[model samples]
Target: MEVAIDNSEFSYLPAQAEALGVPLPPVERLTLPLADGRTLSALRFGSEAPRVTLLHGAGLNAHTWDTTALALQQPLLAIDLAGHGDSSWRDDVDYTPRTLARDVAAAVEAWTTQPQLMVGQSLGGLTGAALAASRPDLVSEVIVIDITPGIDVTAGPAALREFYAGPTDFASRDELVDKAISLGFGGTRPETERGVFLNTRMRADGRVEWKHHFAHLAAQALAAHDPGSATAPSVLHETGWDDLAAVTAPITLVRAARGFVSEADAADFQRRVPTARLVVLDATHNVQETAPVALAGLIESATPARRI
Candidate 1:
C-alpha cells in the first residue's frame, strides 16, 4: 500500500510548540494507506526528513510520544498504528505485530527511502522488531522501550488487560480522565487528563469513547476464539524472538528497572541477540511518561546523524 500525505484533518500549529518546558518543533498530521484497505494515521514533528519514527504501545496513539518528541526536538514521525488513534480500524481484528509491521514499513518507505531509526514501546516494540527483521532496508536502528521478546507476559499486562476489558463508552470525558488517573495511567493529574483527552473522541451518539480499537477488537477476538486460547498478541511473543534474531540493525533495549522486563530477560536478550545494548532506568513500564527527558536522550544517542 502507498502512503498519501494529507493535510485536511490536521495541520501544524505554532501554538503547540512548547510542552513540558521543551520547545517542540512544528508538527503535521499525516495518513498512509495500509495493505488491508485501512488507513494508518501519524504526526510528523519536523519538515526535515524523518530521521526517526516512533510507534506507541497497544491502545495508545501518536500523542503518547508528545513529551518525548518535544524533548527530542528533532525530525521525527510518530505513527498511530492500525486500530489506534485516528487510524482506520480492522474488521478482521488482526493486530498482530507482523501485520502491523507491514503498515509501518510502508509508511517508512513512503516517508524516506533511506534507512531511519525506529523506536517502539511494548506492542510497538514488538512491531518494530518485526519490521526491522523483515524490512532491514527501511530501518537503520531499533530501540525497544521497556519491552522485549522475552518479557514476562503472563501477569505483567494484567493492568492493561483489566483496563481495556472494561466498558468502552463513558458518560463524560471527565469520567474517563478520572478513571485513567485512578488507574495510574499517568504520573501527574495534568498528565493523566491530557492522556485521556488524547485517547478519546466524541461520538455521534454524544457519548465519549476511546479512539483506539484494542478493547473492542479484543472482545470480538476473545469471543470468537475458544476459552483459554492465547490472544492475538501471543504471536507477538512467539515471533518477536525470531524477529530480534533476524534484525541486522544495531538494537537497544531500554528496560525499566521496576517494569515488566526483568534482569533475567535482559540477560537472555543479550545472549540471543549479541548486538543488543541494554539500558536500565529507575521507572515503570510507561517510561516515556515518567522519564521523557532521559528517554529522549537515549533516542538521540541511538539516532544517526542527519543527512545533508
Candidate 2:
C-alpha cells in the first residue's frame, strides 16, 4: 500500500527545516523476485541512477527511512527485510543476518549495476555488515545506525517489546494509533498516526494488523518448546562481529546518544572494525526517524562521488 502524503494532516515532517526548498523525490513501491522464489519489496526513490540502499531495523518497513531518503535527494532503494514489512515471511523462521543478507544481496545484484552505498539500522545494520562481508562487490560503503554486535542482544527497547507483545489485530485504526502513541512509537500524534497507517493492512477478516512479521515470529519463538529449534533461530549468534571485521569498504557507525550502543561498546566496535568511523547523535534507537537531517548529512558525506 502507498503512503498518503498529499493530505495536510499526514504531512508531518521530521526534518522539515533542512528539506525546506528541496523538491520531494518521487517514490515508487516495487517488488523484486529473489533466487529462493520469495519476493523482496522496496520503496524506490527516483529512477535509473546509482542508488543508496537502505535497510530498516526489525519491526519496521521501508517507510521508516522515508524522511532520510527525502532529505538525501539522491536515488535510493529502501527495502523491507524478509519477515518484515511487505516482504514474504520465512516459514523456517531463519531471520538471522546471513539469511536476510542473502535476500538483500540478490535485490542489490538485480537492482543496481554499480556498488551502492548501504545504510542499515539495528537488525538491518547487522544485516548490512553481513552483506558487505559476504558480497563486498555489491556495497561501496557501509553505514550502520545504532547497532553493534557487542551490545547485549538479550536487551531490547522495553516500550517496543511491550508494543509488540500486545494484540495483533485491532478493531479500529484509531485504536491502533492510540496504542502506538501511548507506547511512544513516534513523537507527534500525526507522525505516530502516519506510521501506524504505513505499517498496517486491513485483512479480509476485517481487522487491522501489522504488515511486518516480527511480532508474530516473536510470539511463536516465545511459545516454542525448544529454543534451538529451526522455528526459532538464535537471535544472539556470534557472527556479526566477524562480519563487521570482514568488511574492507569504508564504514561509518552512527550511534544514538540515548540508544543501545554505549561508549564502551562503540570503542570496542572501532577496535574490532579498524576502518569504522564513529558519529554519535543526540537521538534514540531509531535515528533515521528522530534525526533525519543529521543522519542524511552523514550518509551524504560517507557516500563517495561515484561507486566503483
Candidate 3:
C-alpha cells in the first residue's frame, strides 16, 4: 500500500518534506552476511555519501530512520540490524550491543569505502560508540541519539520485556498494527503516524512481531544495564568522563529533549567528547517523528558537508 502522510495525524510527510532534501533511491534489497553467519537486510537511500550510515535502535529496524535519512541530504544507508527486521538471529548466542556493534561495523565496511558518519539510536548508539573506538578510521563522525553511557539502561530491558514477554499472534496485518501502536508509540497515535508504524513486518503465521529478536535482545539489554557490569556508562558529571575519548572524528549527540536521555547527561556527553556538538529536539524518544522539522534543521546545520 502507498503510505500517506496526512494532517489527521503525523503531518510531517513529504507534503512538508523539504523541497531540497537528499534524493531517495529506487526499490532495492540486500541480504548481507555478518561475522556470526547471520544475514542482515539493509536499504540504501543514495550511494553518494560513501561515509554516511544511520543505525536504528533495539526493537526498531532501519525504517525508523527513513525520514531523518532523507532530511540529512547525503547518501544514506540503513540496516534492519541482525535479528531485527528481516535479519536472522541466533537464539543460543548472547546478543550484546558490542556484538551488534560488530554487526554494524561489518555492514559499514561492506557498503562503504571511505570513512562513515554513524548515526545510531539507543542500542545502536552504544554499538556505534564501540565501533568508533574499535575502527576509528571507518567512522567519520558519530551521532548517538537519545542514549548515553550514563542513561538508565534498565529502561530498555523493561520495555523489551513488555514488548516480547510472549508471542503476539495476529490473524492479519491490521491486528498486528494495533498491538504495535500500543507497545511502541504509547497508543492513541493519529492515523497519519500509523502509516509509518504499519511499515513493520507481519509474518505469514498469525503473529505480529517487531523487526528484532526480542527474546535474546531482552536478555542482552538487561545485562548492559546491570549496575554491577564493569562497562556501565558514567554520568555526565562524574569524574574522568570520557565515553568516546578514543574516537578521533567529531561526535554529535542528538537527543529527544523529552526522551530517555537526561538533559544534564546530554550536556555532559557533549563536554566529554573532544570534538562534538549537542543538538536536542522538543520531542519524545522518537525525535525523527515528533520533531522532524526541528531535527532536520539541526542536521542541515550541524552535519558536516558530505562528499559525492
Candidate 4:
C-alpha cells in the first residue's frame, strides 16, 4: 500500500521561529539504524555538534520540542522516542523508561559529539533519569520537566486519555485538530493544525492516523474491550526511583504548577536527591508546548560553553 506521508517536517520551522521572534537555524532530520534493524530518528536543530539532547513525552514526537528548540537557539537534538514519531515501534512494546533509555543512549552517542545537557518531559523525563544513571558519560546535566517517579497514574487529565481512546483513523487532519481542540488539548487553532500535521500521516486507505504507536495501540485496546477496562500502556514503574537515585549528573526538577507532580512528589524528589535544584512553572503537564520560552530560558542558563 502506498501511504502518502509528509516528508517536509521541517517546513513549519520558519513560522515557529518567527512566532518566537528567533532566527530560524539550519534544521535537519537524522536517522540511525538500531541493533535490531529498527531505527531511531531525531531533529538536529543547528549545524554544530549538539550541546543538548531532548526527548519528548509519551504520545508525542520530536517536533513537540520545535518551539522550545527555536527559543533556545542553541545546537540541540530532539529525539523521537521509540514507538513515536519516525522511530520504529518495538515488537515487544516494552516502553519502560529503562528500556527506552537504551535507545536514547544510542541516539545521543550517534548524534552528539560530547556529553549533553539532557532535557526530557513526562515519560521522557523518566527516560532521561535512566539514561543518566546507566550512561553518565553521555549526560552532563539532566533536567526533568513536570515528572517524577512518584507521579499518580490517575492524575493525568481524563480528556487526554479520552482523546486517545477514540478511533485510531480519522477522515481528515482537520477532524483530529477539531477533536483535540474540543478536548482542550493544543493551544490555538493554527497551533493545533500545525501539531496535527506534524504528528499524523495519511494512510493508503485514504484516512489519517497518528504517527505515534501508543495512540493506535490504545484505540485498538479500547475496541476489543470495554473502554473503562482498557487503557494506555503504563509508563510508570518502581524502578524509576532507583534510576533517579543512581544518577551522577547534576539534576534539575521542573515541576509544572498545574501539572501532574504534586507537592508531596516534589518533596519526595528533593529528599531523594538532596543536591538537586527544583523549579515550579505555571503550566500544564506538557511544559515544552505550554511554556517553551520559559523552559528554554532554564535550559539556556543551565547550558555550559560548548565542548570541542
Candidate 5:
C-alpha cells in the first residue's frame, strides 16, 4: 500500500510545460509566516516581482495552475490557500472566502512589489473578490473563473460532492486516482494519476491522503446537511455580492460553459457589478486544466499595461 515515489511537488512541471510548448521558468516554493503562527505557501514562477497572483479552489493547491502558468510565461505567484496544499491548516477550520482573503492579502503584499492582476477559480474566486474589496491596493484587477456569488451550493456537480464526501485516505495513490475517476472527476487516467501524485502524500502509516483540509470540511458539511446552516463555510452558500460591489479594482468574470456558473448566475453578476466584464468559455469547472491556453490569453488581456 505504501507508494515509494519522489516527493518533489515540482517534478511534473517539465512535462506540463512541454505539453504547452513553453520553456520552463525558474520556479521556487515560498513560505511566508502568518501572524497566527501558521504559514502560507506559494509557487513563484519567475525571477522578477510577480505581475500576477493566482489562487486555486478548495481541495486544490497551487499546482492546479501549472498548465496555466506555463502558458502565461509571465512572472506570477500561485498561492496555496490556508488549509490547502502546503499551507498550514487552521484550528477553527474556517475556510470561508472572507477569512481566506485575509491570508491571501498577506501573501500578495509580501510577494508583489505593487498591484497585480489577481486570478482565482471556484472558492478562490470568491476569496479574490473579498481581497479586492478589502485590500484594493494589492489587486489592480481581478479575474474570477467559473464562479458567481449566486451559485447554489447544493446544486454543484453531484460527482464532485460525492468525491469530496467520500473517504479522504486510500491505501495507494492509484487507489485514490481510481476513486476520483470512478466518481467522474480528475479527467483521464494519466492526468488523474499526475494530479494524484501532486495532491496527495504518503503518510508514515503507509496510506495516501489528500493534502487539503477542505476535504474533511466538505465531508462534514455533507454529513450534516442541516437546512440553512449558518455555521457552514461561506463557500457553500454565502452570496459574495457585497464584496464584489465594494471592489474598486476592475473585475472580469469568466464563465465556463460546462461549469458551475450558469447564464442566470452570470447575468446576476453583471447586474450586481455593472462595471465588470463577462467572458464565456467552452470548458468545465476546472477551466485552467481543460482550457489553460485560452485562460492564459484572458489573463493577459485583462492585465493592465500599468499597475496602480
Candidate 6:
C-alpha cells in the first residue's frame, strides 16, 4: 500500500524529501530474500529516485516511517532488521549489530549502485554505524538516530518490556492501536498519528499479530541469544572503537534527547569518529517515530561528503 503524500495533513515533510519524491503512507512493504530462505519484509518507495535506506530498531518494522519516508525524494528503503517485522526469525543466530548490518548491506546492494544514504533508528542506528564502519564502500552517508557507539550501559531489557509485550489477540484493531499508543509513542505522537504502528502488519485470519518474533527478538535485543555465532559483534562496546575511527564516510548522528544512548556516549562517539557530527533531537529513544521531522533534516544534513 502506498502512502498518500499529496494530502494536506501529510505534506509536512522535510525540504530534502521533496527532491526524493517521497509519497504519503508510501508504497511500502517487504523486500528481501535471506540466505536461510526467508524473505525479509522491506518498505520501499521511489525505486527510480536517489536511494535512501532507513533501518528500524528491534521490535519495530518499517512502520516507524509512516511520516518520515514520505519526505525523501530518494528511494526510501526501510528494512525489517532480521527477526523483526516480516524478516526471517532464526532461533540460533546471534542477531548482533554485525549480522544485522550485513543484512542491510546486502539489501542496499540490490537497490542501488551508487552509495546509498543510510538512516538507522535504535538498533538500526547502531547497526548502520557498524555497517558504514564495516563497508564504507557501499554507504554514501550515514545517519545514526538515537544511538551511539558507546551505548548506555544502564539501559537494559527491562526498559523494553512494555513495548515488546502487548496483546496480540484483539477482536478490534482499535484495541490494538490503543495498546500501541499507550505503550510506544504515547506522549510523543500527535493525536492524528497516535496509532501509527497499525501499518506494521498485514491483516489476516481476523487477528493482528506483530510481524516479528517476540521472544527471539527480545533475546536478540538483550544479547541473550546468539543464533548465528557472529564471531564478535559490535554494540556500544570498546573494541569497536576502531571501527568508528576507521569509517571515512560522512556520518551524522541524530540521538533521542532523552533515552538509552546517554550524553556521555554521544560525546564519546563524536570524539571517536573523525568524520562524525552529532545532533540531539528533542525526542525519545525511538526518535524516528517521535521526531521524524528532525530526523529527516538530520538525514538531509548527512548527505555524502561530496554533496556536503
Name the top TM-score candidate: 4
lDDT of 5 at 48: 86
Mind sharing the TM-score for model 2? 0.87
For model 2, what is the C-alpha lDDT against the true structure? Answer: 0.78
| TM-score of candidate 6 relative to the true fold | 0.74
The digit string of per-residue lDDT tens for model 2 on 252-304 reads 99889988899998998888888789999998888998888899888888765
Candidate 6 per-residue lDDT over residues 62-177, each given as its tens digit: 65775666543445777878766667765564556777788888887776677778787767776777888888888887787776656632233442454444344446546655
In terms of lDDT, model 5 sits at 0.83
Candidate 1 vs 5: which has more TM-score:
5
Q: List the candidates ranked by lDDT, beginning with the highest.
A: 4, 5, 2, 1, 6, 3
Query: Higher-TM-score candidate among 4 and 6?
Result: 4
Positional deviation of 170 in candidate 3, in angstroms?
Answer: 1.9
lDDT of candidate 5 over 38-68, digit per residue (tens): 9898999988899899998877889999999
Candidate number achieving the greatest lDDT relative to the actual structure: 4
Alpha carbon lDDT at 88, candidate 3: 77
**Superior candidate under lDDT, 3 versus 5:** 5
Q: Candidate 4 at 72: error in angstroms?
A: 0.6
Global lDDT of each candidate: 0.76, 0.78, 0.61, 0.86, 0.83, 0.61
Off by over 4 Å in 5: 1-7, 220-239, 304-308
Q: Which model, 2 or 4, shows the larger lDDT?
A: 4
The digit string of per-residue lDDT tens for model 4 on 100-143 reads 99999999888888998999998999999999999999999999
Per-prediction TM-score to the true structure, in the order listed: 0.86, 0.87, 0.74, 0.94, 0.90, 0.74
For model 1, where is the 10-residue window of minimal lDDT?
1-10
Residues 1-308 of candidate 1 have per-residue lDDT tens digits of 12233343232223334445555466788878766677878889877888899999877788878777877878988999987888888777778889989999889988765787999988888899999999998999999988877763423344555455546788897886676667666657765666777787777677777787766655454565532222234434778889999999999998998878889988888999898899998877777767878998888887665421
